[model samples]
Target: MTYTEAAEYILNIPKFTTKNKPEHTRAFLSFLGEPQERVKVLHAAGTNGKGSVCAYLHAMLLAQGKTAGLFTSPHLVKINERIVINRDQISDDAFLDIFEFVLGKVKEMEAEGLPHPTFFEFLFGMAVTAFASAGVEYAVLETGLGGRLDATNSVQHPLVTAITSIGLDHTAILGDTLAAIAFEKAGIIKPGVPVFYADTTEESNRVIEQRAAELGTPCKKIGKDAYEILGIRDKHIAFSCVNAYYGNTTWSLNNIGIYQPGNAVLALEIMRFVFGEEGRPDLWREALHELKWEGRMEEVLKDVYVDGAHNVSAVEGFLRSLPEKEANIILFSAVNDKDYEEMIACLCRNVDTDFYIITRIEDKRAAHTKELQHIFETYTDKPVFVRESLEEAIDFALEHQHGRKIYCLGSLYLAGMMKGYCNSGEQ
Candidate 1:
């Protein structure tokens, strides 16, 4: 099948609540000779920072001169971003080949009255196949949803499982409380496997600790107390970590947000567990110095910044990363499922935003521009403007920026769209 046709087939499939069976993923792997079995996995799951943690781990592994694969979700620009090996996205031709192979197998299964794998499952299968074929030393996986039934969780035993800060995200499927969501995220902890998690609330820590105890798994956590940020100067954050395993090590990150110290500590702890003596301080320095993860406090243009802070906790992180000076204009959009009201409240609490430009992104789940404006207006006296088109909202923000910063946030979809808009040559 052509790559475009293959993308249409996978992209059109329902993302959640489909005929995707957890066992069917395993069965499909069995049919394909279980590529996952050949690769050592570092599985990560949580409400936020999962992607950032995975990105850090993948970069560090590569810096350590290891062949690594990364499989993340909800692609910003293209579907190929979800799969990578040796720091390169799977080529379109390779994606087509893998998709056609999986589609052929899926057809065979359908002919035998077997259910089809969901879109995420298919892409995950492709990642496993590609990683194994390429002989990657490690594959860092970010869970697509709640970890208990997430397709990536189908890996029987990852080398090390890490859970980022747990919060009230995916409430409908995961649960409404922090403990319940922690329970789902802690599902990645296999028996006797060492698990590392970012420090969160007391309730969340309790839930994760209880799960680890039941499985006899060793659990380590990185919290604010574990790391101290020296300063953030010119988009670079200098920090000192006082973790038990890694000791008191000072490091600096290039253009990373204020909240990244915790994620960095988590990645370092996981690396300590996985690579041990092989973890070189030199490689760690190089990785941190050049590490980059898009859609998180990213300065895409000269003074315009974009962040994917869709939920309450993530918005708080995004806010912490911003300059104390207020933004001249803020362009915001988010999915309907997010707590944008709280997110906007956090933004207002942190930044003296002058104007709020509410926009709707290209997603069926996007919150309407009018609804966002209503919520944002209730939080701040900033004049709220509505533009259903993302490009127009960006234009409005840029045109009125007046030498002050223009910040776009609230959703990764919105951030991705704005990143494309700000970087377009025509702009």
Candidate 2:
């Protein structure tokens, strides 16, 4: 099948099947020759920052002269962005080849009366197959949702597992409390595998610690106290780790997210655990300096940025990264499942934006522009404008920026839409 046809088919799979059991996924992997077993894996899961952690680890592996593959979710522009090797996306031809191979296996499974893989499961299988086929030494896998039953969690063994900050995301599926959510994330901890996590809250920490203890696994927690942010310099956030191995030297990231330093340190600890003495802090430092995870405080244009801060906690982080004195203009959109009211209240009360522009993502889950506008109106006296079309919102934000920084946030889908629109050269 052609690339377009394959993508269409995969996207429509969700209509036919929901998430399968981890055992089902494992059996499917076995049917596909157990490609995940051929490569060492680093699995990461959390409410936020897991993708950033996975990206950092993949970059470090490449910097150390190791062949690596990175698999992430919620592609910004293209499905190809979800799979990468040696820092480049799987070529369209390679994606097509892998798609056809996996489709053949799915047909065989169906013929035998086995269920077909879900959308994420199919993509996960293709990613492992691609990585093994290309002979990658390491593969960094990011969970699409909660860790306990995520499709990526089907990988039974990983060299190391890391969980970023746990928060109240996907509360419908993963519990509502921090401790409850932590339990779901801690499910990725395997027997005897050393697990690293960002110690965000006391409740979450206790849950993770207990889970690790139950499995007789080694666990280390990295907290906010582990790193200190110096300042933002030249559009980069600079910080220093408290770890003695990192010394008193300050490290800088290419992006301007204050939360990134925490994510970076979590990846650093995982790398140290996996590579031991072979891992060079200096090389890893250099790799982090050049690392930039898209859709997280990414400056897409001259003074316009797109951030994936859909939840209340992520919006709080996005707020902490903004400039204290500069005038700002925010273009916001969110899906219906998110706590957009709280997110709007947090942003409205925290940042002194000149005004707010509300838009709707081109998805069925998107919150209506009028609904978002009403939320913004209820929170602050700031002028709120609504544009149902994302393209129109972009035009309005840009036209009225007036030398102020423009931030597009609230959803990954919004970030992806903005990036795709900007990349289309219509801006």
Q: List the RMSD of every prediction in angstroms.
A: 1.7, 1.0
lDDT of 2 by residue, 223-279 (tens): 889889999989899999898888887899999998999999999888888788898
Give the alpha carbon lDDT tens digit for every residue of 1-427 in model 1.
Answer: 6888888888887743375667888887876678998988999999999999999999999988999999998888889999999879999999998887777887787788777788888899889998998999889999999898888988997999999998777788889999999999999899999999988999999999999999999998777787788998768898887755455666888765788888888998888877787778667878887877888888888788888877788877877777774677888889989877788888776788778888889999998888888888787887999988977877777788778888888899987787667667657
Per TM-score, the best of the predicted structures is: 2
- List candidate 1 stretches off by more than 4 Å: 15-19, 243-249
Backbone clashes in candidate 2 total 0
lDDT of 2 at 366: 87
By lDDT, who's the top model here? 2
TM-score of each prediction: 0.96, 0.98
lDDT of 1 at 339: 78
Alpha-carbon local distance difference test for all models: 0.85, 0.91
- Give candidate 2 regions above 4 Å deviation: 325-327
Q: Quote the positional error of residue 333 for candidate 1 in Å.
A: 0.5
Give lDDT: candidate 2, residue 145: 91
